[model samples]
Target: MTETLRASAPPVATGAGAIAVLRDLASYVDARAEAFSARSSWLVAAATHLAGEPVVVVAHEDGQVVGLAALSVTRHRGTARVTLLGGELNDYGQLHHDGPRAARALAGALVDWLRAQRRWSLDLTQLAPEDPALAALVRLLPGAVVSPGAPMPRIEGVGTSYRVKRDRRRKATGAFNAAGRDGLRAEKLVLDDLAGLERWLPALVEVRRARDHASGRRSQLDDPGVLAFHTSVVRGAVAAGAGVVHVMLVEDEVAGFVTVLVDGDTHRLYDGRVAERWLAYRGGTVCDIEAVLRAQDDPGVHTFDWLRGWTEAKFGNAEVVRAGLHASSHPSVDRLDRWEATARRRLKAALPDAAVRRIVSR
Candidate 1:
């Protein structure tokens, strides 16, 4: 039986009710949904704290949210551009939808919405190559430019074996003995409530700052807006019982940490950082191994996603999946946007890291 579909009005802002529904739909539709990014909580949080205007399009069936797309309108190089909300931090780009039919309807609605917002060209990043949303977009927008994005590594059946656990202990003891550090411990904080998130978030941010400074790089979390968005999204996910924070300490100080989000059966490491000084002690390895143990114990989770990176040596043994990038615009502006993007990439590559950071912050 065919379902009746009706797209909501050009969305200026989504109400709480609709947003909640969209949040659930994301997990329902995407098997490997990065809860921190795919959920509507991310969209709402980004809209609240990040710059630029928010644009959301919704498709409903029987008065329930069946599909949706959340976007932001901003000026890029003096031209209005539309991009996926939370694109900078999000691991994947997907149209939140119920199924194949809803995907097609949502794609059609996106086309109409894009036409109405004629001044803005679309640029979506990190789309999974096999995503129905990507397929729908390509089918409808044949002229859209498509490119390959980074590969996302994932580990299935992530439970640690007896040998792995023994190796971990051996490494920890050896490192502790060599460093002469007696106060070494790891704590995996299962932040299922807002109060816990509030308590630990500041320390996590500071750890990230210290790590960046040690590595001679700047942390994006240093930006007040980005920090606020992350706070909101994590809090929202934790409150929904879908996320947690794992922190490892040395001498009772934060040494390394990672945020994990469980979307259905998949566990994802959203972000993590380790202090440079602690690298000698395998701080990051300890934290990640513990995450794998946690996932193994949880009957609800079966896979652990390492997210976007080709660090084979670091990950040991994990499978790789393809991610994608794409852009679409009116023929008049397509060439212009593409050219401007190429120029910006080239200039960014040529400039010093500090110079590029300054330009991006502005």
Candidate 2:
């Protein structure tokens, strides 16, 4: 039996209409067990609003929305390009589909639609290597390019007792003690602290800026759009009970802060920053350890995800490698995207820490 599938780009509206679509799509994705950050209606709406355009592509199977490919269109160097809706903010780009057959049909249809629109390219980076939709798209689009994505570090067993290396554990504990001796107190930001969140956000941006300047690098928060988007999303997430912020203060002055996103049993560290003046006290490390402890204590959290990158801090925990995908009707564009991705990996490998940070911050 042949399954009928059709794809269409729907105009996304705000308010009640948007919520209705999100509710329906979220329900469908949850039923298929293909839920992820990008697939969430909240995130989709936020991404669309931040992008200031509507580019949601829906795949309907027998008159029901079974899959979607949300994208944001932007002009780069005189050429329009389309990227996953949340862009770099999303750790993983999802193509929410009912199953393999539906995924294949959606992939083919999406490709045809994209070609007809004549976009320069479509980039979906930092996808899990084993993502079903990625495999389907690659299989259907012969010109698609595959590349390695930054490896995201994660700490599993959040709700259980997890073991850490003895030396690292000792160091983390020592940092916590040092902070305590310095009269630094840690607290989790709650819904009631919306005002505090507003205050601390700009402080975090400043701290990040100072740290990056000292290290001779740029900060992503330097971009007005990125900063605005983060501020809006974090505010919305907190209101929706989907996010939390942890803060460490010294004499009532903000010293460090960490923002995390909650999705069911998992918590992802979205961003973190520490005042440069507090580095000697290791405020950042202390804040991180406290955040981990809180996650372990919370009955709702079962895993702590450091998100898409490996660092020394994540060494004692488990890690996962994600991949990136690029596809275009033009073979040359596909090759170029692949080459650029490979070059980025190589550059990151060869550059000094400060130089690499500068490159990535942009």
Candidate 3:
């Protein structure tokens, strides 16, 4: 964890070298983040995908990817938004480090890289409270609000309630029964028993897209790689003996769904979506609740994170709220506000009332 301060941050200047970092990342990430991030390929792939983009920067450690930062640039709505591409499901940094100081060094390197690139700002998704890298970033960049655009969703554990929490015996079981009586079913998939995800991906994508269209929003399913990555997540989760994709079928229909990220000690829910048609049943909550019940089966799991944004249900139900930290050197809390104003002005001038969406390249 000791500091080995480098004179400069790493970037992909030469095509051959950038390709090397991508490959090294793909390999080392396969090992370092192997167990931590369930979908190791996607996190590692972030560097590979961003390598081809016009603007992308990565921090290298001895020709290996000890750390990386991806920026997804778009000039939508006449304003620019740079998505600080990390994990879409959670706003957490998965740096390859031996200790906290190693993580900090990487953070400093990434912030410096971004600033050098002249990016207006960045948006990190699904921010986690325990990320020490982000903590160090806040130390360097005092002006960044960790929670700017994206809001973390609400989350709760089955055992964190009163009626079932009075005693430890049967906590999850009690909650599951209550949910079932309320017309919700909670269960995990037997990896071998279900259809191959190669087959499931397309159908799942359709369901997700339709759900999004019905909600008047764009489905993440629109992107082929994003869809592929999600598909990989399902496959990886099952292969690791980690957890299953819990589905909340309403009246024998895929009413809501959530992919639970699992390890021995942590269980996280991602891609949680509920159809607008199921509002009466709180379909989203139903799926979320069911996922938690299934997670309880893993006695080793102690923390259930909503993973990024704050939500009404998650805050109300969770006994412990993991507050995410945002550290940046921007030095002005009003920077985001100022950028937003510029974006608004640019949008009006450029498109003249047309909805401008900056196409984010991988």
In model 3, state the lDDT of residue 48. 44
> 1-362, model 2: which lDDT tens digit per residue?
11222223243333344444555465454454422456565455455455534355666666656677666667654345777667777776676677777677667767766666664677887766776778888887767788987777777886575634467657866765676676766443432256757776777778777777667566666767667767777877776777778777665555677788777788878778777777766666766776777787887777888887776666436777778887666666656667989997897678887776656456
Runs in model 3 lying further than 4 Å from the true structure = 1-39, 47-83, 87-89, 100-104, 111-200, 250-252, 276-286, 310-362
Against the hidden reference, what TM-scores do the models get? Answer: 0.78, 0.78, 0.61
Instruction: Rank by lDDT, highest first.
Output: 1, 2, 3
CA error at residue 204 for candidate 2, angstroms: 2.4
TM-score-superior candidate, 2 or 3: 2
- For residues 216-256, write the lDDT of model 3, one tens digit per residue: 44667676666665566667666666656655444545555
Candidate that scores best on lDDT: 1
> Candidate 1 or 2, higher TM-score?
2
Query: Scored by Cα lDDT, where does model 2 land?
Result: 0.66
User: Candidate 1 residues 218-302, lDDT tens each?
Assistant: 6778789888987777777788888887776666666677888877888888878876767776556666766766887776677
Output the number of the TM-score-best candidate.
2
Model 2 TM-score is 0.78
Candidate 2 residue 289 Cα shift, in angstroms, is 0.4
Looking at model 3, report the run of 10 residues with the lowest lDDT sum.
Answer: 353-362
Model 3 TM-score is: 0.61
Off by over 4 Å in 2: 1-26, 29-36, 39-42, 45-53, 159-170, 176-195, 331-362
